[model samples]
Target: MLVRTAYRLETGLREAASRVALRIGWTAAVLPYPGYGTQGRARVLGRVLLAPTATDPAARRGVPGWQRLLTLERPGVDVVVELGGSRRTVRSDEGGIVDATLDVRMPEGRATATLTVGERYDTATVHVAPDDARLGVVCDIDDTAWVTNLHDPLRAVWRTLARSSGGRRAVPGMAGLLQALRGRYPDAPVVYLSNGPWNLAGPVARFLEHSGFPAGPLLMTDWGITPRAWFRDGQAHKRSSLERLVEDFPQVSWVLIGDDGEHDPDLYGEFAARHPDRVAAIALRQVVPRPRERAVADDPPPDSDHDGSTAARAPSGTLVVRAPDGTGLLRGLRDALGVEPDRAGDDDVGW
Candidate 1:
């Protein structure tokens, strides 16, 4: 939330909306606080605690309990806030996706509200094209880029807590790597696609901004992805996401970096195969976790680890690549985005 802090220091946190106005559509329940930090950075906070919307007496009295509040995230992000007698779902067996129509006396009176799945960002999602001439770097966050994750789960959890509680922790050599990228393309903004979901938004943002991981448009998933949806999108979604980014801008070349720990290699490989013209290089990070640790922690199984013998076969004629560090690939953001360097270098960019 460096951005928010800087802004408050300049213009101060807006007190006018202290009571918490606005209803987040059940699909996206996020309160947008412009500049929660200082200067032009975002300082997100858990201040906007949310609950089921209050209603008139007649509306409140007439409610159904069977209308399951299908929980999307299987692990349950933290705690579920009761709907105050509102219809609730029994189970949302999906990864974090469930569909349940609300039952209300005045059915039309039912409105959607977004619960805090727990994440925040400073950059607006950027649209990119795979074949742009400008440099486009896709960096992984775990050990390859730094060393925040890929360690003892208990210690990692504690580090996460410390960030929320105002503790500062940094991954060695991460900021320098980011600065290195910045030096390469001072104008082209970077995007981070992490396996972490919206649940870690607040804490993750706190860690990255302080540590330096190109705090720009970060593409993260909501923990609420349905099991079926997760299965369906596993490799396809990530590949499509990167491709869509390439298509949206159409003026950059992609430098894909990720660790062999997850599906980064697979996704990057698929993108490279289908749009071979756009992808320049692929880098995989080498993790040092013990095999016992790997077996215990690799929940849901990382796709890359399994692809050692078998490869994902996509219709686009794309094949996945396994890597140890993302830096091995660098066609440049200009080539990845398909944008003119001189032109991209002059645009106003904070996202």
Candidate 2:
């Protein structure tokens, strides 16, 4: 009852704020995120926000992550999405997120969906995987792709809240590694599945592009309160997202990439066990604990013998590799996937 009461209060406050913002001449705008799907269906991802009519162009260049969280959500707004000669109207959720899957026959490769909220318009890119595409890549963002210092809570908060997209550092060689994956499986789709909030979608996309990572859809979750709980379940979100991917692309096998800093190992292990045939391999980035974290660690120290040198097999018979960074993982993946080393040194760049 207390939780329900809190949720109601939060909803009421947001509605009041939305009304005031609209009365003050704030206009509804659509902020689109890249989506992915099969040739028969496409998922459209975006958010509806109420923003000022006149915004400073200069200030928009490198807005800090914190400012993005302060957006006034225009929930339940109608957004018209046009793709593949079909037009459909979808309503935003309570969080102003427009996640609609439309049945439209688009050719394999890149496609665009036009989203219109009121008079404002934006385009979302949707990657349509071919029916024959068997391999896919799923990556975690935080410590796996970039340095978030998740071992230390305070530093992680500082990095997430204070840093701009350009200011945040990318995991060395990760972009080149992803590029190698793309080159090896040209038709395969690489999806970034992160636990980060949807508010940072723009910044995260910018970071991935600027850092030279392969372009793909970002599956992010919302922060704060949900219908049943005060805080969203990050682990549950990852689990459900992975399951949904299996349902959407039943023929595609995935190389799951994440870090051991948190629960990636356990989560990926569970998924691979459930869908053994769907998971091609599991790559875990071994994050060495910080001094403070080590002091309070409950588990024993990792064995030195198994540090990125050996390959293990999960219970599902899927190959598992552990590396400290992307370069090692790329090499391990090459051996596991039976791909020869790149003579052109493409994977050696962006370190």
For model 2, the local distance difference test gives 0.82
TM-scores across all candidates?
A: 0.46, 0.90
Candidate 2, residues 208-243: lDDT per residue as tens digits?
999988889999998887668888999999999999
**lDDT (Cα, tens digit) per residue for candidate 1, span 90-195:** 3222233222222222111112222233342111122221222266666665555445464557655544434341354444444554565566666444666665
lDDT, each prediction? 0.40, 0.82
Q: What C-alpha root-mean-square deviation, in Å, does candidate 2 show against the real structure? A: 4.1
Which stretches of candidate 1 lie above 4 Å from their native place? 1-29, 32-133, 146-170, 225-234, 289-351
Query: Model 2 segments beyond 4 Å from truth?
Result: 54-59, 290-307, 342-351
Q: Model 1 reaches what TM-score against the true structure? A: 0.46
**Pairs with backbone N, CA or C atoms under 3 Å apart (clashes), candidate 2:** none
Candidate 1, lDDT over the whole model: 0.40
Q: Can you give the lDDT of residue 40 in candidate 1? A: 18
Displacement of the residue 44 alpha carbon in candidate 2, Å: 0.8
